[model samples]
Target: MIAALGLAELKLLLRNRTAATLAVLMPLAAGLYFALGVGGEDDSWTMVVTLQLLFSFGFTVYVTVTTALTARRQDLYLKRLRTGAASDVVVLTGILLPVVVLGLAQALVLLGVSMAAGAPLPTRPDLLVLALIGGAAISCAAGVCTSGLTGTAELAQITTAPFFFAMIIGGLMGMSGGEDAWVFLIPGGGLGTLTGAAWGGPTDHVLEALASVVAWTAVATALSTRFFRWDPRT
Candidate 1:
């Protein structure tokens, strides 16, 4: 049942040309832009990895999931799913699975492009993998919370902006070594730390980074549990 719903969601996602383009093209384009235009003569894998995370996990995942969830709620699709035999977890997971998969694929594509463009392979592959998993999970849960506040599909972009920008800016700052201690409280800060560690930048903050990611994930999950609405907003 979950598989069937996931397939249906995938089809729905593909049919939406705008969403499909953003999910596929945006990450690729951003990666190439940063890799070629930004990295310059210094083979900086940090820039590549940071940009990939920002574009893939930050923008693409958050916006796509929020928009999709908002559309489904507005169209009564989520409400209909609630009436089915699928449990809440299965229903929500099925709806979100495609976006999650796409985000991971985009991450891999970005990594490949970065490597081809002269960025070295991750120095700490484990840290990179951890960052990717944590970032994706955080983005998906954030999207659910964002969708709860969105009144319509058209409003999703605006509604998701604060969270998206927070991640982008905080991530950039964290990656650049702006250590205020509080930056790690933001969703993307831990990801930045982990990604930086992946490039052999620092390992002293790994535990803090992991804790930050886990903490944000917990907050986002709690928000979604409390506020996520299946039906359209009145």
Candidate 2:
């Protein structure tokens, strides 16, 4: 049942040109642009790769999931799904699975492109894996929380802007070597630290970075559990 719903959601996402662009094209394009077009003697390729991942998390996964959820809820799709054999977790996961997969795929593509463009292979693959997994989970949960506040599909873009910008801006600051203790507190800061560590930065902050991502994921999950609405807003 979950697989069927996920397939249906994938088909719908592919059919929508705008959603397809957001889910795939935009992130890839932005990643390539930043990785290839933006360069400086002091700029690190790892930082470029980290920025690309941030774009994927923010503009791709976060935005696409929020828009998809709000659209489904507004159209009564989520409510209908709840009446089927699927449990709440299955229903929600089915709806979001495609976006999550696409986001991760894009992240891999960006990593490949970055490497092809001469970025060093991750020194700590474990940290990179953790960052990718944590980023995807956080983005998905944040999307659910944002969708609960979105009254319409059209409003999803606006409602998701704060999180999108927060991750992007915070990620940029971190990648640029911001060492402030509070940097890890930002939504995507931990991801930046982990990715930086993957690029061979200091390891002392790994625990702190992991903690930040876990904390954000917990908070976002709690918010979604508490307030996510299946019915359209009146």
Candidate 3:
């Protein structure tokens, strides 16, 4: 039952214009955007943008947009599935796993290509792993939470704008903070620290960074668990 639902979800996503574009084009575009945004710096700034890409996509695009899109269009199908052989947990996992798996796979592929093309390997592998897991989980939960608020598929684009802007600002500030007072308030600062640690952060810094992602995850997940709607708004 889980396998069947996963297959169906995959097919449905493949047929959507937005999902197809996001899955195929968003990563490369993000790489280019980050590269350009940071101006090919030799310092830790560039690393900041790279990890920002991972967090930004996981939260801004994947969690928020895709979840809302699926809920708006397929809520009926999803609600019905919950009543069948598949458990609610299985049904949600099937719908959500494809993008999460694809994102992780793509991140690995990008890491390999970046290394081949001269990027250095991560120094704090544990920190990097935490960011990947914590950040992605939060984003996924946030998406489910937001989907409960959305009214239609088309509205998703407009609804997701705030997160997109937040991510862009976060990425930019993350790359340019020079002990600026306002930097710590920016979520991207924590993300930058994590990315920097991935290049070998001090133990203290890595712990702090891990804490930030975990805090974010907790907040998003708590909200999602409380408010997420399983049925269509109509």
lDDT of 3 by residue, 64-165 (tens): 344534553455876677778888788778777766666666666655555545566787677667656655665576666666666776666666556545
Question: CA lDDT of 170 in candidate 3?
Answer: 52
How much is the lDDT of residue 71 in candidate 2? 89
lDDT of 2 at 187: 92
The C-alpha TM-scores of every prediction are: 0.96, 0.96, 0.81
Question: Whole-model lDDT for model 2 versus the true structure?
Answer: 0.86
Clashing pairs in 1: none
For residues 153-229, write the lDDT of model 1, one tens digit per residue: 88887888899989987777667543568889776988888888888776887888888889999999999988899
Clashes of 3: 1
For each candidate, the alpha-carbon lDDT, in order, equals 0.85, 0.86, 0.59
Off-target runs (Cα >4 Å) in candidate 2 are 39-42, 176-178
Colliding residue pairs in candidate 3: 123-198
The residue ranges of model 3 lying beyond 4 angstroms of the native Cα positions read 32-41, 48-52, 59-75, 171-188, 201-203
- Worst 10-residue lDDT window for candidate 3 reads 175-184
Q: Please give, for residues 120-157, the per-residue lDDT of candidate 2 as tens digits.
A: 77889999999899999999999999999999877887
Reference-based lDDT, residue 65, model 1: 90
